[model samples]
Target: MDIKSFIDSTYLKTAAQAGLDENQNQEVLKTFVNEAIQEGFKLIMIRPEMVSLARKIVLDTSAKLLIGTVIDFPSGNSTIETKLNEASQAITEGADELDFVCNYEAFINGEIDLVKSEILKGTQLALANNKIIKWIIEVAALTDQQIIQLSALIKNVVLTHFSEADYNAVFVKSSTGFYKTANNEPNGATIQSIIMMLENASPLPVKAAGGVRTYEDAVAMIQLGVKRIGTSSAKEIVHRRHNQNEY
Candidate 1:
């Protein structure tokens, strides 16, 4: 199934989040970037601060690994200006793709104009820079109806303002893999959520992130029409697929 091509090998934890000192955290990031290169994953998704290092490592190797960084991160409540500035910095530092956390909270609060404006501006900046972009909707934070509406909203914004060719460059991604829910409920991508996104965000691809832990889970997402799967378990999933084939 060429599962490796569908994987966005991800590591977005900060020093304190991972319980490591700054230097040790960076060392871990270096190893993560090297592993993605050796494993031939489609892209390496990291925090914006590490884009320069990842770019340098990829340039040193002959590997075609792409570097992607998040904008506005787990919280999508940042002002539009803040989001744009973060995105611009990431691009200047050599990120091939930018995944922006959509203002899902605003949308949930009925602030449609704010959400729409950010999507329009964010998508515009990304396309103008010739970099692929994805909007993380944080499905776990929304209800079923909100998911459908938000997906359609993003698709509408892109389709209305951008040309047909630019559609592929904009994606409606599922989650950030970092949301905290009450009682530790599943706060990432789920089958039902993905199905809703795929059906409404069509034309604009969907990326299933968070909670995709196994070869079977990844395959399920792909089969359901997702173009990418973001996970920290990329190596384990690939190895599981190989082990299954051997048996």
Candidate 2:
């Protein structure tokens, strides 16, 4: 398959405005997401609150509406119950997919079981509802060893996929832009670490987000066997398309 087809975008208008009220930004997202999907973008990740809106707009058409909000958001400190409840709400509102963040503190603090339970529960939630799950192993906040270990442990995930359990689709995401100025370098090593893990997991897919805001970056990620890319700049990438040039 062509790598470009793997490009999946994550978007939230409230997320776009640093200080806008949730209600106002909801309108902004409605406009932005509706326009983007109408322009032929297939898979899109939206916030949970906007899931019903996004779903109402895209469910009858070819564009696929997938919901992917932060469980603990930029941080991963929220309890598993909170995350699971959020996932349940999203699915109830019509989420076709899920993008969740692992508790970085838990992972760093050696609470490996806690992290696993949350992620595994997310997988189960999505699976039970016939949705696809992509665990955001945010590679940005982790050390090399942590990255390697996280990848290895999560590689055994038995979530939904095209083939067998081994043939998975884990998304090794980068920063959620929670800390754009974070010290963890989102360099080649981050990508390499995720790629390494994806390879180790047979047919798993990596999703490179944060800091990847250009066509070149998207293309590079595609070449790396990434089946779905999470980017907030979908419009920027498709801005020059003659067909999509109107908006």
Candidate 3:
């Protein structure tokens, strides 16, 4: 498979999060965007503030790399209006995709209506702007049953409110690659979780983010039917695949 096309070359950390100054962080982001363009990855997933810069860099090149930004990232507790505002701003700044952290906490807390409403609103906004949307379910924070239920919930929302042509544009992504788990457990996409998501979120598509390292891991996810793999180690994964092919 052309693994590079399945990769969303990602760098979502902020200046504070990466323990670097603003200028230093911008330099890092610039390098990341340049490298992604050079490598011919499908997309560059970045923070909202960097969307304009990334868009500018990509435009300077002939690469068809899509620019994606997270909305209400890591935490999915933002109000529906807040999430929409953030998504709108990202779109205005030239983002081609918006990966919103879904309100899993509210869903687990029995606020089903609230979660459903946000999904509907968020999906609507993205489709209206002709952009792709993915709902990050943050799998590590939930139980197995919760994962299945939540994945199905997102699929239901999209299938019910949107047309079949729009199904490909909406995805049920696995994680934010930012959620913390107790005892340093796997805090990202696991084989089991991906299976659950794929089985339940079919027709809507699934993007396995987080904990997906190594070329083998990426291939495994793709084999199991994940449409995209989100990772900070995209270049390394591609290199590993090349080395394996040479041997």
TM-scores for candidates 1 onward, in order: 0.98, 0.82, 0.98
Worst lDDT run of 10 residues, candidate 2, spans: 158-167
lDDT of 3 by residue, 1-247 (tens): 7998899999999999999999999999999988887888889999999999988888887678899999999898999999999999999999999999999999999999999999999999999999999999999999999999999999999989999999999999999999888999999999999999999999988999998889989999999999999999999999998898899
Runs with alpha carbons beyond 4 Å of true place in candidate 2: 1-4, 13-17, 59-68, 157-166, 180-190, 239-247
Q: Provide the overall lDDT of each model, using Cα atoms, as 2-decimal numbers.
A: 0.95, 0.65, 0.94
The residue-by-residue lDDT of candidate 2 on 126-210, one tens digit each, is: 6667767676666666776777777666665443322464334445555565554446556322457657656754455666666
Model 1 residue 64 CA deviation in Å? 1.4
List where candidate 1 sits over 4 angstroms from the true fold: none
* Model 3 CA deviation exceeding 4 Å by range: none
TM-score of 1: 0.98
- Candidate 3, residue 163: the lDDT equals 95
Better of 1 and 2 by lDDT: 1
Task: Pull out the clashing pairs in model 2.
Answer: none
Error of 2 at 154 (Å): 0.4
